[model samples]
Target: MTSLAAPAATYAEAKDVARRLVEARLAARPLAGIPGPLPDTLDQAYQIQDAAIALWPDEIAGWKVGRVPAAPGEEASSERLAGPIFRRQVRQATPGETPFPVLVGGFAAVEAEFVIRLGADAPAGKVDWSLDEAAALVAAWHIGVETAGSPMAEINAIGGVAVAGDFGNNAGVILGPEVPGWRERPLDSMACEVTIDGRRIGTGTAASIPGGPLESLVFLLGHCAGRGLPLRAGALVATGAATGVHDIVSGQSSVVSFGALGAIACRAEPARPFALGTLAP
Candidate 1:
């Protein structure tokens, strides 16, 4: 087996490395013995995850989710796919207008999603919020693209120390048009497709998400709360992909179509290959 990268040399160094990369929107390079495979709880997961982003001195946008079940669609309930998004990246921006500098790589994948922008406060009271309750607070809904490099074999294989060193598998997000029906729309019945150079690559149904969108919010609410973050009204939550995963590479443009709702497109820009250790700074 390929042995995992050494953990950070110390707790402080691990925190600093994670912070530097997150804030700078750079890659993660951990020191030996720092990022150990021991932070098992969701709370611990966010501490490392959040702190990395916290290193950025910008206003946090919202949250991104993955590993949600794909039921009544195609998943066999065994392979749980997941990743993260910068809170700020989840905003209701124009299709091509975004502040983050997107690095271009041909290995891009577009996933269609319904975005839920919070319209109310999600206090961490002892009550279990219902799906409808979570939906009621939506400010708007839009189609989007969640892209990353081709699934790295190491990232797909390891979930702890290794994932941390990879910047939480985040690449970029593109927001499309806002739906009018918003919260009242039935997401499960919605369908979408992934297109590369105008060719259909994959198709998916919203029902792939176990309980649809609110289910994603429920999971996200707790994930943030566990990290001491209250769900603010302006936050946007991406439910998950509507179509199957689509992979792409550089010099190519990709788009995800969710039928009449709308489609988000991103043209990949070339990125220079950075040596593994280049992320250390």
Candidate 2:
């Protein structure tokens, strides 16, 4: 696979590039390229994220995976979309009633995911961590909905490398308040019901994630370790989307909850189209 962990930049420097990619998308303008919007290659992205962590001293909030669903009647386990979380967006957990923003000209969708917070580090590239070792690292288990936006549609149109350079296909996230003992719950058989104003729209099982939520974390730990990265202690993991994306409308209410785990019900407010933010110095 292509990676940014190349020879030119040190791990720290490479991470900065990845963080810059995050800023660019949140600050996109003017032209839209096919393969990518960044001036660098996908291989360079590995370095970008590497540097982002080093120079920024940002919190490794959590991990998020994507495309967890492959076929109908199948599970979310076999799919392969994943990424890390920045600290700022992890804790603003919403339960009861919360308001979420939507870009008038942005791509966003809601998905159901299992949120797992770690008590120990799941360093990247470990051949394997025992279940007890893995379980010991976890703190709380919760069901949450991530209202994520991405630059994928346009970036992927050109090249995956291009998409790779674009923000790890993310915008922001919302956790639906923490659930009690979410990890101990039968996440695999956990039933998820996604509703729009009380109408059921989608259904999913926790086991859909290849190895369930924890397995997804294992994959990420392995993936990052191979690149010389650490999963970090207290990192929250948003295992892939158990239920794929659902279209939303402004001013409409969207609520998603899993059986006895946790639930997120929020009102979608569309932001008026306006001039983009001022250019950074």
Candidate 3:
């Protein structure tokens, strides 16, 4: 966890940092540090994220949820954190390998994900939801891969506050086929494995996610509602990593398999700029 010794970042300061991060992301360049004062809390960090979202030339396609690991013996401020997944970065995996971009000299990793797509809009005024209520909003569950990257290589080392500030350390996602009869299946039964460069790197199941995937959706429903960013129908949610975050570099190949359901193969490419004014529809 990031120590709260520093004063919370003011809006102007947070925006400046957000601008720098957004610019670095668009240009596929690396930054030496957070461009402004480090946000002392997750709320302050999200303020920075909102500013970056406004500056980004893309629409929100989905949101990715990640665990906020608590230090030993200390309670975590929150169990999970969320970040926007831009439209341009969302890809549908096809036969053979789908390529994802990674910023060299920065943070880059891949996580096997259990994704949920919303079937209907969540009530904007609803701030609390039960597990069943959250599950009801899901259109489908799919096997996917979350591409986690940041211009700051030390983002994770800085803790959740920093990660929340920079798009939840998300770069993109590659969605695979929907898992049929997912509702009746225990998440832990949907075992997953991540292999990078022909070597198995990580393995686990949705059971590893605290409380399970629907609980993650429950958290997001409230988290977004509180921020006035109510989730829309068709939005996707990448529940926390099923296996674990495994590091990779440019040119490496990886495959994330969701047993019996399907698998998505991806190759990493050196990240390229988003071309100054380009925006995805």
Which number leads on lDDT? 3
TM-score for every candidate vs. truth?
A: 0.73, 0.71, 0.94
lDDT of 2 by residue, 42-119 (tens): 456545545444433346677676643323454434535455567755646554666766554445567787777777
Alpha carbon lDDT at 137, candidate 2: 76
Model 3 per-residue lDDT tens digits across residues 1-281: 44433567999888888888998898888977677788888999999999999999889999999987454666654479999999989999989999999999889999999999999999997999999899888999989999999998878767788899999999999999999998999877999999999999899998878888898899999999999999999999999888888888999999999889999999999999876853332
Q: Judged by TM-score, which candidate is best?
A: 3
Model 1: residue 118 alpha-carbon error in angstroms: 0.9
lDDT, residue 63, model 3? 98
Kindly provide the TM-score of model 2 when superposed on the true structure, using C-alpha atoms.
0.71
Task: Encode model 1's per-residue lDDT on 2-86: one tens digit a residue.
Answer: 5454433344655664554453344422233323443433334445655566555346565555552233445434322223556
Off by over 4 Å in 2: 1-24, 28-59, 68-79, 123-127, 130-132, 151-164, 177-184, 270-281
Overall local distance difference test of candidate 1: 0.55
TM-score of 3: 0.94
Candidate closer to the true structure by lDDT (higher is better), 1 or 3: 3
| Residue 135's lDDT in candidate 2 | 70
